[model samples]
Structure formats: C-alpha cells, structure tokens
Target: MKIPILIVMLLLLTSATSKKMWKTRYFTKHVVQQQDTWCVHACMEMSFGIPQCMALHRWLEYSQQLIFPTLNCCDLITPDNYCNCVEHGGVARSEISSFLRQQFSPISGVFTDLWDFLPRGDIVQLAFLSVRYTSTYHLVVLREVEQVEDYLWDILYCDPEVGYSTRVYNPNKLEIIY
Candidate 1:
C-alpha cells in the first residue's frame, strides 16, 4: 500500500512540475516568407507560431469574404503565383490588423516611436518604406530590440524579402500596428 501511494505522489509531482516547465520552454520559430508578397503572412506565422501557408490560406479566405468580394482563389498550390492574383500584391495595414484581432487576440495600439513604446523581446509586425523600391511599403517581423547606448538601439528583424534574419540600427519610417 505504501509503495503504491509513493508512486502516485511521485507521478503527481512530475506532472505538476512538467506543466510549468513546458510554458517556459515555448519559443517562436523564425519563418521566412516563401514569396515576395507573403511578408505579412510570414510575420504573422512568426508572431503566432503558425505555418506561413496556414496564415496565407486563412487570410485569403477572410479577405475574400469581406474585402475582396470578387476575388477568386486561383492556383491554390502555388503561393507565389497566387499573390499576383491579388490587386496590390500585398495587404493593407487596416486589413492585417482586423484579421489579427478576429483570428487571434487583440494587439496593442500602433506605435510610431518604437523605442518609447515597445518592450524588449516583443514580436510585432513592422511596416516601413522599401529602401530599394521607390515609394513602396514593406512589412517585416520585429523580433527583438536591444539597447546599445543611451539613444542608440539595435533592431533585430526577419526580412521576408531577403528570406533571413538581419539587424539594423535605428530604422526610420517604422510603423507598428497591432
């Protein structure tokens, strides 16, 4: 009887402790955008820890119903080709925010000043003007912010355009929409 009781107590303790450990072990995976226009989808995947294809499929479904009534689901197999079927080849900020709120939890307010409002290690979708293209906007995932000095800070992000993670110092024209 004592042996069985001891075994039950040990099993209960292990299960209880394992739950706490599992929560702390949660981490986001770095997902690269499969296509040029899938940057926002990739950011969503990284932030929510979902697959990029899943994000695209869900967003496409959502947008088709409300925003793009005439939109057709063409070439479902190829995401890159499917992106071209959209009007702008990308989604607007308002649409992205609305989708996020309805699909996931509500995000914080839009912050133009990254250093002032954003906290460290907070994953956020960032919008900025394209450096290579003229008057074009691009989206990336802001993975982390590390303060380098009193006024200087390093911004780490996953750039879907380049399909990798890169760091920049004091990026300009940054728009954070939750």
Candidate 2:
C-alpha cells in the first residue's frame, strides 16, 4: 500500500511540473494567436489597385464571415481624402503625420493597418506575377509569404527582373506588391 501511494504521488508531481512548464513556454512567447488570410488577401488587394479595394470591400461586407473590412484609398490621403497615390512625394515625417491623421480620423479609422517601411513586410507572399518598369523605379508582387520568423517574414512576388526584394516604405509613398 505504501509503495503504491508513493508511485501515484510521483506521477502526479511529474504531470503538474510538465503542465506548468508548457504553460510558461506558451504564455511568455509572443505567439500570434490568430492569422486570417482574408485579412492578408484584402491587404494585397489594397496594394493592387483602388478599384479592387472598393470591390473587395463590398464583397467582404456582404459576405457572411464579416471578419475583414473594406479599405478606401482616398482615406489614405489628406485634404482630398480619396487619392490613391501615396508617392505624390517621398515619405517625410510631416507627410506621414498627415497620412496618419487621415488614417486615424474619428469617422473612419481605415488605413491604420497600413505599415511603414520598417514593419511593412509582415505577412506577404510573392509569386512573381509580373513586373513593371517605370522611369524611376521597378515594381513586383510575389505570390505567397515564403518565410515567417519572430522578427520578420518574406513574400515571394515578382518585381522588375530583380532578385528578391526587401520592401522599403515611406509616408509620402506607398509601395504595393502587386
């Protein structure tokens, strides 16, 4: 009887220790609790064009899940509040602030999720769909997110015949993968 009791107590102690260890590991780490691809897809659509954003926003709103929201390019701008161009100039602090003011507007706080250069490339995938060559810069949109790490991640998209791209952002200009 004494030996059996000892074995039960040891087993219970081991189980409790393991459970506590797991709880610590899970809670202490900054793990992303949820990942909604529709959010990602809608973001990509915003990157692609204004027409698409409008259309997708309507669709998401009409759809059942209601998990994501529609975006407005004009909301990304100020004074006009409907312009689709962020790169009217380069990203300066003042420009970004103006953009943010528009973004955080009390009526509609859209574009809040828009990322600056440093944190922009969070969850995108580049499939190298096609490339465009402008007089000044080249552009590409990859297909899928290639890697995700604690610090950063990569999306595999097409660009102007260049190698892999690490995106850079500024308040004055908004660069999209598509």
Candidate 3:
C-alpha cells in the first residue's frame, strides 16, 4: 500500500512539473498613437519593438525608396522635411503616416491567427481587414503570449495610437485564412 501511495504521489508531482509553463506577454509601451496618420509608424514600432520615433525614422528609410529613389534617410526625417512629401506615394505632415491609411482598398488588418504566431516571441506586421478597435488605415504588431489554454488568451497588440486591446481573438469567428 505504501509503495502504491508513493507512486501515486510521485506521479502527481511529475505531472505537475511536466506541465507546460504559461505566461502572458505584450509589446513595449512606446507604441505610437494614431495621430496625424501615424498608424504605420506605430505598427512599425510594435513590430520592431522600438520607439515610435525610431520606427518613423526607420520607415523613412524603407519608404524613401518607394517614394523617390534619390531620397535618403536624412532627407526625409530632417528638421524641416519630416517626410512631408505631398506628392508621389508620400503625403504631407509625414509621408509614412498618410500612405499607411489607404482610405480605400488594401483594407485594414490582415485576417490571420495572430495568436498562432505570438508564442514564438515574434512580432508580425499585419494589415487588418477592418478597424481593429481604435485604429484606421494603420499597421499593428501582435505579440506572443503563452497561455495554458489559448481560448483564455487575449492576444496583446498595439494600434498606432493605443496599446493592448481588451478584446480577444476567437479562431472560430476568424475563418478566413489569408
């Protein structure tokens, strides 16, 4: 009887130890708010885990090529320039900000299982099919979260202007995979 009881207790202990450890996670607080069409910049920051300003500056480098081949990082983010390209793929106030808000086609937020990729500590760039809570024509980053049951996990994310939504992602509702 003692041997059986010992075995049962040890088994229970081992089962608990073997269970997967779960945790909740999210992006940095430096997420840029949706201001002056800064959704893309904010998304970039969330995706890259950098400051909003740095994301904007880096985007200046990435989009500069698309807007104008001759433009450089410094040319777009200078004190006077600030990516104020009113023409081309760019827009005023900040070229990166305006272009992100297509205001038409291309949609907002990608229809993806953001939760699927969050566990790996990956930051994915997403364009939503609809306005995700408070953002429009913006980019956002989905952070990885570890939970014992995915059903209980509300994916943590930051819109251009806000950080972390209260709502959670339901796989059943989001059937469109793309």
Error of 3 at 8 (Å): 4.3
Better of 1 and 2 by lDDT: 1
Q: Using Cα atoms with residue i matched to residue i, what is each candidate's TM-score against the true structure?
A: 0.60, 0.20, 0.42
Give the root-mean-square deviation of each candidate in angstroms: 11.9, 16.1, 8.5
Local distance difference test scores for all models = 0.55, 0.30, 0.42
Tell me model 1's lDDT, rounded to 2 decimals: 0.55
Report the C-alpha lDDT of model 2 over 1-178, residue by residue, as the tens digit. Answer: 9999999999988765642100000011111101111222222332333242343344343332344434453355455453323322222222333332332222111222213322433322221222223433322333333223232334333222332333432223234321
Error of 3 at 128 (Å): 12
**Looking at candidate 1, what is the lDDT of residue 128?**
27
Quick one: best lDDT, which candidate?
1
* Predicted structure 3, TM vs. truth: 0.42
Please give the lDDT score at residue 144 for candidate 2. Answer: 36
Cα lDDT of model 1 by residue, 55-79, tens digit: 6666766776655545443344363
Worst 10-residue lDDT window for candidate 3 reads 85-94
TM-score of 1: 0.60
RMSD of 2: 16.1
Worst window of 10 by summed lDDT in candidate 1: 18-27
Over 4 Å off in model 3, which ranges? 3-28, 34-36, 46-54, 64-144, 163-178
